[model samples]
Target chain A: MRLRFRQSLDDLKEKLLVMAGMAEQAIQRAIEAYRVRDTSICDLVDRGELAINRLEREIDQMALDLLAMEQPMAIDLRFILAVIKINADLERVGDAARSISDRVRELQAFPVADLPIDIPRMASLAGSMVRKALQAFIEADAQTAETVLSMDDSVDKLNGAAHYTLLTLMKKEPNLTPQALNALMISRSLERVADHATNISEDVIFWVRGADVRHKMGEKPATEKTGTRS
Target chain B: MRLRFRQSLDDLKEKLLVMAGMAEQAIQRAIEAYRVRDTSICDLVDRGELAINRLEREIDQMALDLLAMEQPMAIDLRFILAVIKINADLERVGDAARSISDRVRELQAFPVADLPIDIPRMASLAGSMVRKALQAFIEADAQTAETVLSMDDSVDKLNGAAHYTLLTLMKKEPNLTPQALNALMISRSLERVADHATNISEDVIFWVRGADVRHKMGEKPATEKTGTRS
Candidate 1:
């Protein structure tokens, strides 16, 4: 029974990593769609969303079944609960990808001038953070999770740059307002994806170290950074 | 032991409702601050964030504790999981409120001009949805949760209106681009609050009925409408 329970937990983790990969790919494709003005990539995002949604439901059911049947305790219980919360975050990250795809569709409908912003860079950072967070979860690597946390500030800086740049562009060339606004929305979506990644990393830390490092109210205890990368 | 477990779960639920109330008020005040261009109210939102963050941690810890201690099964397991998910959504709603407050501060920094759109109505709808979602959770009213789901479409409509109106205003009155963009961001924040509220309501339904109505792929038999108002 104990072995089966452990296997069930591992199975749930594997499925969550798969779902995370799907969300990350959707985000990557959505960014590419923005760069190439490719509506076909948006179609890919839309189709991929169905799979992500289905994965979310499957994971949720597996979690419920594990709880009902095995009655996991202590760290196991925390793991299941963390999976539920992380599942929601992953689903929202998928939604953010869909949001970006929708914005790309809007930009296609209304021909817009080129933006002087680093939107793809922002998306790339956010996507990397998401991928790293999942890898940390699969490997139970607290150091990688911490790295994901540190990258959040950089994503915020990018979002701020995107915001101010769009504001200035809108002021200078009012004709670019619609496209600039769409680009700003895209930046916001990427920022949210990064936030979700941070959430996943926090859960991984909790899972591995049995510590709650969220909200970051107190000074984090100084420790030599472990070189754990998966 | 079972009685103590039930009590702890109830306590967690009550605390969640209280946190939900605080977040709803913050969202309401943030909207008022935006409408009135009150920087002080915006500051209130900034200060109140710490409390919301702390409540989120507290609720999360409590949910995990209950799950570990009680090893709750079936509906009980679902209830604890729902609390964990709903707690995250509430914290995000607080973040949306803070975003609106930040926009209010930015708007106040600039010279006041004739507003380009109806933002308060959108904010109010978002706030009401948050409140009603909590009410649904407390009462286990799946119908009210469904109502919250339906209302999300209305918020989306308002967001579209806000965007189109602001885009036209920016095109017609190029000088108002900065202020118009700020208003657009504020409207986007309101739409996000509604989205979070819908997420909470969906969690409530999942807790009560064990049905995942999230992506609209699964059709569960609707429960009787518990028309309870909080």
Candidate 2:
């Protein structure tokens, strides 16, 4: 029974890693779609949702079965709980990617306007936060998770700057409003991608330290306080 | 031991209901903040978050303790799992409220230029969804939960209309772009609140039916797809 439980735990972790990879790839493709003005890449992001959703259901069932059969105690229980929460966060990361893709598709209808925000840079930072958080989850490293938390502020600043610049662009050149609105929405989606990354890191901290540091970042924690700040 | 577990289950339900109330009230208050254009009310929405976060921690700890102690199986296990999932959704309902308040605060910075979106109407629909989903959870009524699922389309339609109108306003009036953008973000936040409500309903169905109906809505449920859509 002990050996079976350990193997199931390993299986759960593996499935989550797979889910994480799909989500990360979806975001990368979505960003690429935005950069290259390619709707076909956006279609790939949309097509990828089924596999992610299937994995979500599968992972959730696996975690549920583990809790029911294994009755894992202490760290084992925490680890499964963390996996469940991170699974939800990763699914949202996929949603954020899909949302970005939708915005990119909308952008395809309008002529490309040169916006001032560096979207690829912001997306790269958000993507790295996701990558680092997953590494922390794999290693159960609370320190690396904390590093992911600190990176959120930089993404938030970039999103804020993006928000200001996009709105200014809209006010100055009304012709660009369509593309600018799409860019603004895409920026918000990336910010939420960072938020999901922050959430994954917090879940890792909770799992490793058995501490609920979700709202411990500041007054209320940016994850819950102002998640859609762009 | 069985009696103790039953009592603990009731305790968990009551705590969740309390969390549900706070989330509902926060959304109501945030909408009121927008309706009245009052930043002070936004501050109230911000302050209430601490209690909401505390309850999230306490409820999660209670659920986890119950899971570890009771070793619940079958429907009972599903119920506890539902509680955990619902707890997360309620916290995000709180976050959605806070996000709306943030936009309301930003809206206060600009002069009140009446945009085309019927925000109060959209908010009312979203709030009703939350209330009904909680009602279904309390009663374990899958039918009521399904009704909540259907209500989501109307909210989505409302949000789509709001998005179109707001963008048109920004394009036509240029001067109203800031206010229109704020309205756009607020509409998106309400849409997410509806999504969370949809999620709660799905959890209720899963608990009662033992069927995963989350992504069963369409090709993919809007809750996990296009969640941040505006």
Candidate 3:
């Protein structure tokens, strides 16, 4: 491997981390907006999305150029491919944050209800998953990625519970129907963020271990199921 | 440029088409189940998901092997990369179908309502998007892919209408809460299917013209916004 190619790879990773930071901040701000009914935070999320989208294109182009020029093989090849996949996930995470913010904007027009759903708690879990998944990607940690995968199930369960709670609330008080549905959509968006994080983690595992772990429910680690190619 | 590599690429594309067929079938079956309140079609969707998942793994492995082994450049590289992205989209399409089927199974337990939601029409539109997107991919037709992108807005509008109508129905008759909510969820799933189709079409355009058309809303075609690399 050439030193210049290694530097380019490092640069790609740095850009991806910057994009991840933007996405994480957007989610945090969106949740903060929801907590305090602050419409300004929603605006912040909307503004951040453009930068994230731009970074996505830059990172994708960089990775593609690396693959095309260097023609990297083995672990280097895997790393570039993983970066491409993670770049897509991070952009979608930003979109999810924007979606949550969209709901917050809608909720601002309606009366705030003391809903039974713990959306803040769900957002916190999802945020943690995003942070952990990015950490796994940075360090190429398969175990951390696996932990992120497990956390996805928890987030999913919370999303289901939130849906049920909102539905019950809407049924009891018809006036709260729109507000409850907005909350439900926000919960779903947060679940999608967690899902994108899980995808990044899966890509990390694939990068480190060269194993396809997706849709293999209850499957063992990459080494046990399919021997590492790297 | 090797004959064997070309044959391998052809084989990968064939597998992708087969997987696309399975995904399309799953969506069709799930919608049929919802329309007739048939639990059996839902069962078939559940069964079809396993095949889709397996095909996803096979396609990913094949694409990765090609990238690593052949190390092809130019259009071959783009084509393989596009296949990988489209493969992921198709699998998600399958998952969306399964989600709709899950809702259908729930609806089967409740009394069916002649709700104002045009879910069947939404499903048809979304299904055609998937088919046309795949056709664009097969032919590398940027025009068809652009058409698929434009159709996404319509599906989104229909999804919004479904949400509005279902919410109104639920508020008017609280007894229809669960059933209406299921219909609402099914509508959302179909919307997601359309989204995945749009993603596939975007990948098609990217592959055909070497232009990143994503996130360039309101922008003209590749020749106008960005010149073609091919």
Clash counts per candidate, in order, are: 0, 0, 0
lDDT against the true structure, each candidate: 0.83, 0.86, 0.84
Assess the local accuracy of residue B215 in candidate 3 as a C-alpha lDDT between 0 and 100: 30
lDDT (10s digit) by residue, model 1, range A65-97? 777655454567667877887888899899999
Candidate closer to the true structure by DockQ (higher is better), 1 or 2:
1
B1-230: candidate 1 lDDT, tens digit per residue: 67877787789989998889889988988988987888899888988888999999889877766665644545677788888888898898889989989888877767887875788888888988998998899898999999999999999999998899988888778778778888988899889999999989988888877634322323432221111101
Indicate whether candidate 1 or candidate 2 has the larger TM-score. Answer: 2
Error of 3 at B48 (Å): 1.8
**TM-score of chain B, per candidate?**
0.89, 0.90, 0.90
State the fnat of candidate 1 relative to the true structure. 0.46
Docking class of 3: acceptable
Residue B166 lDDT, candidate 2, scale 0-100? 85
Candidates sorted on DockQ, descending: 1, 3, 2
Docking category of candidate 1: acceptable
- Mind sharing the TM-score for model 1? 0.90
- Mark the regions of model 1 whose C-alpha exceeds 4 Å error after superposition: A211-230, B211-230
Q: Indicate the TM-score of model 3.
A: 0.90
What is the lDDT, from 0 to 100, of the residue A194 in candidate 1? 98
**TM-score of every model?**
0.90, 0.91, 0.90
